[model samples]
Target: MRLERTRREPEAGMAVRTQLPAPPAWMRWLPALFVAALLLVEPFTPVDWPVSFALITVPLLAAFTQGPLGVAAVTVFAVLFEGVLAGTPCCAGRSVGYLWERHYVASYVCTILVGAIGTVLAAHRTRRERTLADVRFVAEIAQRVLLRPVPHRIGNLLLESLYLSAAAEARIGGDLYEAVPTSYGVRLLIGDVRGKGLLAVETAATLLGAFREAAHDEPDLPSLADRVEVSMGRRAMLLGGGEVGERFVTAVFAEIPTEGHLVRIVNCGHPPPLLIRSDEVSELDRGRSAPPLNLGVLVGEPYSVDVYDFRPGDQLLLYTDGITETRDPHGVFYPLLERLRSWGPLPPRELLEQLHGDLMAYSHNGLQDDIAALTACLLADQPAEPAPPSDGAGGSSGAP
Candidate 1:
């Protein structure tokens, strides 16, 4: 597998296209079609019955799909066409000079008034759409920076991640994950902040930043967790309020050492990671737990790391509670463990893809909360990479 960075072309150098979303071709031409239909039937209709009066609806139709300028142009055309239909001798059996009649003139004035109103509505609609587009653009950029993609392969491990926000338009949320190659091992972190909104985003960012830095410096998983805890505590202190104090992040940290079949994990008030081996799946519960980040002082529990044998073909799955908590129409929670046991073994990416599809189907696309999951598999029979040479002090150091 290969890691690829996607680069977007600079918008400054690109030509500006109409900001309005594309609708059907027939819909955009509906106003013109309405005018044509009126002209065709006007000649056949009686003098007492005038079909051209319906031209007032032309501008309204255009306003739905066209910009202000387009709507105004259509409005003007409709008024002029109404006059033509009124004056044509064959149309509605009217005389040539009927265009200047009091009723025809009234029809022209009313069409103009309606057109003006439609133009104003179109302008307001366009502005609101543009503002929404800008907001979504900014949100997308933030997501890329905060939840950067994990490298497909780190050491002998293959990794994949999936994230979904409960909100329809939201691209990022409190759920977060990251993987980094450290001198100690291939360290991975996945976690979820307690609540939603800006505060939750801030908390997730702080924890990810702390993990990235501490993963390289801290040699053991417990020390790494401690460093992260200290960072979270400092951040909570800076916020300085009771609401901020209520904020806590549930996380699991895993380290696959440079040369070993054993994997170490430190779970802190988070769901246990899944161990998938062949046809059997089991939870990697450490039997005891550490308090979540920001809750160390309140829970006052010391952190501990659990070691488990991770064979070459075994896969590890880390996720937040959102996955299992998703409910169907019957209010039954999704059975993730049971489903995994029934499925055949697949690659990390394909496995997550299937899981994502199943979750969406289970919830009928009505997700109640943010979801995040990361899966990593040890490549079968691949030899571990050689560790970097140690310095004179007997400590190994190199780029992660």
Candidate 2:
């Protein structure tokens, strides 16, 4: 009997305005501090030397953190303060009669000119910042749609996902992941496209759409992988034009049975998933390698499914090459396996949080490639003498 798949309504949430945040408090007050410091020091300077001229820098400094109006206000204050210092008899022994001296007039005029220039700079900076913020906001929305957030719980499996783009301002890239709970089991997909930019992102979307739909319709893991491969081939041919060979995806597809102690995985030129059992980590490398999606046409190799023990309390991590290829200042690659060994057992969410922080620190917050990672930990126990439940005809409920 085929189970009717229900369509899920698109998630709706508050559309936050991700505008640039206000400047830091200290930065905002820096111009004020500069004026105060000049006021405090002018009294000690020689009578022949006047430090009030330095007030011109105050408006310039304000340009960095304030809008044009604020900069203009600072400029006016600076011009007025200059007159006060020049006429003050107690400071620098200057007389009130000389407040509007020709030199002081020139200083005021020059300060006004500098302030005008600073105001223009502040306006330009403000416009560019707003434009950048708008671009980022759109990128964030695209990320939500392309790489939708993975649910923390899927059946008896607890999942956590993390993605980082090489471009600092980018939220979505070639890296992609998706998890869907189907009659077959909880199916997961993670992959990275070969190249970068819009083409890579489009390819990733194609693979994700194919996986999400096929995971439910295809009964078996290998068959599902085959469907995805075919979809990728078509997408690449359409997008690549004459360069179809350049478009390929390194991916890993996994299925955890709804009632079993094993997981089936099909890796297509992707880094093998890591299995963590009782403080020990090992790679689930298949003896025979399979070509990446879209390359099957050229390589003419069949996809292979490998079954591995994934009982309750076991955690499996699937990641892209970006995590392993990260390099430090010393030119040494990140040691993922070595690092996982050192950490104690943690929940999937905490484990990924630690990995993200550690990876950023190891690379000094500099990543040269897009990264995607998914961790799944089994949370339910298998019944003793477990057997696949029958659907109706006494046949096993599990997919062939």
Candidate 3:
């Protein structure tokens, strides 16, 4: 894979992203070579080179950083060096008695055997690490494909999204949002799984997977909501006793009709999404909502849907609390909607960037939690382009 050098960044760029060049291969093998050299200098298998305290230091440090492969390489080099120098006339063959002595030969030979076992152990661990990396990479790629970039347009609305995980190493976390055009309307979902790591991500994946399936099958937003809850309940029941592990997500699901006429909203204990239209910004009416999904908690018959008329150019902003909950220098809560109302009518990408900048500034370049933003705007319809000239000479005389 090709690696790109980072020259500039929107905000703080971690220095680790620009690590120095790796140490030379010979340097990697130096410890092994040095161990082999000990047989000649000590004439004993377990020769204690006070300097070889590096044996523990080097392998552990190398293993911690470069891992088992690096340690294995060093081990191999040591074995090869020992083999070349082993039993090679320590006294210049002055006599057969001295040359054939068991003490002289077997010491290095047994040392070689021990070194061989060590190499085998190190190599095995190295292979396991490579396998883990491959698996993690595949999982990472799957997360990206499943949650591809939010489309620029959804139905009659223009869509923009902002997403950032807590790490450069991970592409996803417990936070997810998606907007898609379906027969029912343009459907959108913004959700946050309970935790901060892989298990939480797995829960989110479960929700999205279930949503995709049920979205197509269920007739209305309420029915679709029930289907999701049912799926989560089934998952919980699968693990023996009853309810699953402690997990929950606050979410908002909305549907915008094809011509941007009506917007349907359903809340599931998630952070209230902001509706910005005509210079007014406020959290959509919460009224009374059920507990988040997967907690074995749900309520209401129809799970009431809040419907609003969405005109062209109106915007819907979906976000996790990470942005709103961000604390400032004196620990005052960030005022997200107030600031958003102040900076009215920003396009989706600019809206996200501006909010991200504000969050960074509020925290003074430190964020205690992850931030994800998805914005959808209903744009006025576009006129179709006129049909092309029938003979290519309508605008200008033939060739002139």
Candidate 4:
């Protein structure tokens, strides 16, 4: 078996898209229209009721939709409008100064103060939004580096994976998965760190890095698991800082041979994988299970590898606890096995797509934990036929 370690880079110079939609044309002219209407009515209204107080709405609206400079311009217009209205002829043919009584002066002062405060608020909001955008971009890059995309096809098996972070705004969390084609077979790892945030992310990165390197050097599943445990222990020592209850990771590792009908798995305090056949779905539970990595010191015995049949037309699903532990509004846990029974046999991609949609619908789109799922379909042992080479012109390249 040969290992394919390929990294795909994103297209260069992609632009960031803004989430807030552009303000409507009518909204852009709303402040001007409002001020004009107030001016037209000022001659008819009584001078005792200062109309300038209503002018504050212009800057208030601008604060929500426009930048600081735009809000400042609106504030200046409001103050000028109030001053002009005070001097204009009004009730009983009174002079402009007649409108500037004690109450009128107080109202005029309040309007100017309110507009200034609105401009400052708009500036502060814009700065906060920009900072959030920058942080989100960094989090996305970190997620991509830690959990590289799994290829659609690995060796003879078709693969599919899905990851959903509970923190929708951040778009990333501690859940992780990696599939590597090793000399022994195609080894896979799906794991979840015990906690959330950066600490969990660091532990997940440490686990995946160790798995990718050790999968090739270790002779068997048990030894490979040992390597990961050792790596996690070292990482915990650096991260724990003498804390008593440090973080740990629960994982399920599996190996599918190049030309075999058996799959070997090691369950390290993680949920058991589901084996789906023609008309049956069963959990691949073992008699013995080991403690999660970084907590191996608590166990007296070594990890046990469980073997199960993974024949043609069969699909195996590996997932983190987030899937089974999800609860609906009524506190009902998700019925993974019951739901899979109706899906019948499907391609890895379609199966995951349907499952993800159903899961969201079941939870009303409010999942409390980060979820990671990997599905592997065992294709025929014989190699697939190669397609004909394409002519140089932009013709069809044939089926993949």
Using all chains and alpha carbons, the TM-scores for the candidates as numbered come to 0.83, 0.90, 0.62, 0.78
**How big is the positional error of residue 285 in model 3, measured in Å on the Cα after superposition?**
1.3
Candidate 3 residue-wise lDDT, 163-254, digit = tens: 66555445567878877678888888888887777667777877888887877777788888888887866765664442265666778888
In order, what is each prediction's RMSD in angstroms? 8.3, 8.5, 9.5, 8.2
Q: Name every residue pair that clashes in candidate 3.
A: 250-270, 251-270
How far in Å is the alpha carbon of 337 misplaced in model 1? 2.1
Ten-residue segment with the worst summed lDDT in candidate 4? 1-10
lDDT of predicted model 2: 0.85
lDDT of 1 by residue, 1-400 (tens): 1111222335523423324456799998888898888878877888877778899899899988888999899998999888887777766665554778888898999999999999998898788878866776677677777888777888789999888878866767899999999888899899999999999999999999999999999989889999999999999889987786788999999998878898899999899999999968999995777888888888777788899999998999999999999999999999999989988688898898888888888998888988899899998766579987768666756649
Query: Candidate 2 clashing pairs?
Result: none
Q: Model 2 TM-score?
A: 0.90
2 or 4, greater by lDDT: 2
Give one digit per residue, the lDDT tens place, for model 4 in 1-400. 1111223446533335434434688877788788878867766677566666698778887887688999988888887777666656653256646456566577667777888888899898788777767776676567667878788898789988888767756556678888999889899999988888777888888999999999999988999999999888887777657542467888999999886799999999899999989889999996577898888887757889999989998999999888888889999999999889988877888888888888788888878888889989988878668988778668876759
Kindly list the per-residue Cα lDDT of model 2 for residues 95-157, writing each as its tens digit: 543588888888999999999999999999899889978988897777778887788788778
lDDT of each: 0.85, 0.85, 0.66, 0.81
lDDT over C-alpha atoms for residue 47 of model 2: 74
> Model 4: clashing residue pairs?
none
Candidate 2, which ten residues in sequence have the lowest lDDT sum?
Answer: 1-10
